[model samples]
Target chain A: MLKIKVKLVDGKISKKEMVLNKKEVTVQDILDILEINRETVLIRKKNELITEEEILDNGDEIEILRVISGG
Target chain B: MDKSPKCSRCGKKAIIDIRYREEKLCRRCFLKFFEKRVHRNIEKNKMIKPGDRVAVALSGGKDSTLTLYILKEMLNKVKCELFAVTVDEGIKGYRDKAIEFAKRNTKELDLTHIIVSFKEIFGYTLNEIVEKNKVLRGARGPCTFCGVFRRRALNILSRELKASKVATGHNLDDESQTYLMNFFRGDIESSLKMNCDESISELFVKRIKPLSTTPEREIAAYALVKGIPFHMDECPYAQEGMRNVVRVHMNKIESTFAGSRENFYYFMNEIIKHLKTKEKMKFKLSSCILCGEPSSKEICKVCELLKIIRG
Candidate 1:
């Protein structure tokens, strides 16, 4: 089983150990696990933005973010 | 090996089960699950008109370039006339390359182009102004000068070209960023103005954004696929800036929220529809003190910029 650790912009960690061995997972799947909307969040795996369709691999550290909006 | 086109919405592998036409938005984006449902929403709102003379404000970026391409296609069906205008801010390194791209694309599109130079019109390029101002009042932000100057310059050129409507390259991401910025700044009036459709104002030409519903990535992809000339280089002055921070933050929100950008427009539209602004139009005009054109102040922003150059 592939275990993935997740990090939030506020430095919060996901409580669950994500097992990604069963099937292909995506950035959206991780967001689903984290219980956040796509619009309110951005994901970076290894400091690069991962679009929703980007398949996830084992041992990837995902950073989720809430973007700031305004002038 | 799979033999399907990438999803247009998400750029993922196309699953045959989804019945998508082209590109991979998955089942999610294909169903219009986006937060900023700009594509359909604009059609429902009836913002675009047939036979309109549209002068696009080109910045040689992905958004504006793709906007011109799409508008060119859309207008063909509607018999609309199209033109291009680029405001040269004279930013060394940043704008020089973009202007070249803008001019190239204008020729490719076979459209009449107008290039307004800050150096010629304002007598001081951005570099000169920033340098001069820094010696006196210290270093003001690049955006502080660029935004005011470019907007005024575009408006004047749009009028000079006798265009009824000035089209902008503002897309969903830009609009969403602006909406949130206005919300944070407590600027309800400006927010309301953004959501409002093109209306004739004495002070300025009517402004519109035909690509308001399109996503930033889609525009970039369109530009790339169509091979439309564009400047991808990051502006030298744009590093670690406040708007850059806002852009990064907006992208983050956009990734998490399926329709955050769409939601922004809806939110603004709702406010405009129901709770209209009680605040007076901040720049209501008497007349342009110099050119006798309509202006919010005695002298318009365009005239003020010209005075700085003429002095």
Candidate 2:
């Protein structure tokens, strides 16, 4: 098994040594691993919103944004 | 069930009936006082006129929908041509629900509705634009996208519908929240712009918020009374840190003071008046370089967004 680390640059949180067979994974799996709530968070892959079922390949930058409220 | 017998805002026994079946406000004192405040503000500003084509910017939210309902009823007393325009940002499940409710309410009210979609005209929804634009996250807020496009879309549609002036559902709570936010941010000029005075900039379509005198609780009650189809679930994005903090702070202040809403209006008014004297709040109007619409800069916000995304 190959090991890959997940890093959230904006929030400065890092996860190290995650095992994966392939170079790609689904967005939902990623969120599950990160323990983020999809309903409260908006994930953008390649600048477009990605549903949980969609797949993300290696080198694909992702953004996890918390929805802003108020005026 | 003996209903919850208290005012949501003050936590006192609702001495009035602000909403039927709900312990909103009492009839004798609070109701009369609140309604009279609205009437006084309307009369002082002279917001409505006979034979004027008033295009209401309805968002299917409690505020805008209630604005339409009240303005329509107000027009019965003073005859005016009232219609509604809704700009669909094409936010998939979110905006589609709003447009449906807006359309349904307009039909029920016997008012004309004009629906415009970003996809139909601009070849992209907000979803599409966000997908394409690299500078979306840190560079611009959601309002930067929604507010910019929606303003132009509403103005263009209203002009096509031959509206003399445009009306929005900006209520006192909304205005007060904005004022507090601006004051904290130290954005004096932007705060001045948020002022809902009668004579607005004439470069684009003139906009007014007649409900600026009405509280959010009152508007929500009015919407419920009219049976308007409004979405109550707050948007998912509403929990963003900075704005949510501000909202919580304002809510605390509002609860502490009975006339907090009215005070916000007067405070902003004083700021606007002072800014105007110093020429700091004087609006600069120029034709949009692309669309020839009235704008502060050579290019309008819509054109700027298009250029940024299309590039």
Best candidate, DockQ-wise?
1
TM-score of 1: 0.70
Please list the residue runs of candidate 1 whose C-alpha ends up more than 4 Å from where it truly belongs after superposition: A1-71, B1-12, B15-42, B198-200, B277-284, B288-311
For candidate 2, the per-residue lDDT at B179 reads 80
DockQ score of each predicted structure, in the order shown:
0.08, 0.04
**Per-residue lDDT of candidate 2, residues B1-311 (tens digit):** 32324554565444333322233453234545555766676668778788889999988887788778778878868888999988888887777878878988899899989888888767888877766764544466555676678787887788778788799988776677778777888877567666545345454576778788776655544443334568655554446435566666655565445566567778787867887777555765668889777676788778888877777
Q: In every candidate, how many clashes are there?
A: 26, 10
Interface RMSD of 2: 16.4
Worst 10 residues of 1 chain B by lDDT: B14-23
Q: Output DockQ, candidate 2.
A: 0.04
lDDT of 1 at B98: 90
Task: Tell how far residue B38 is off in model 2, in angstroms.
Answer: 2.8
Give the chain B TM-score for each candidate.
Answer: 0.79, 0.83
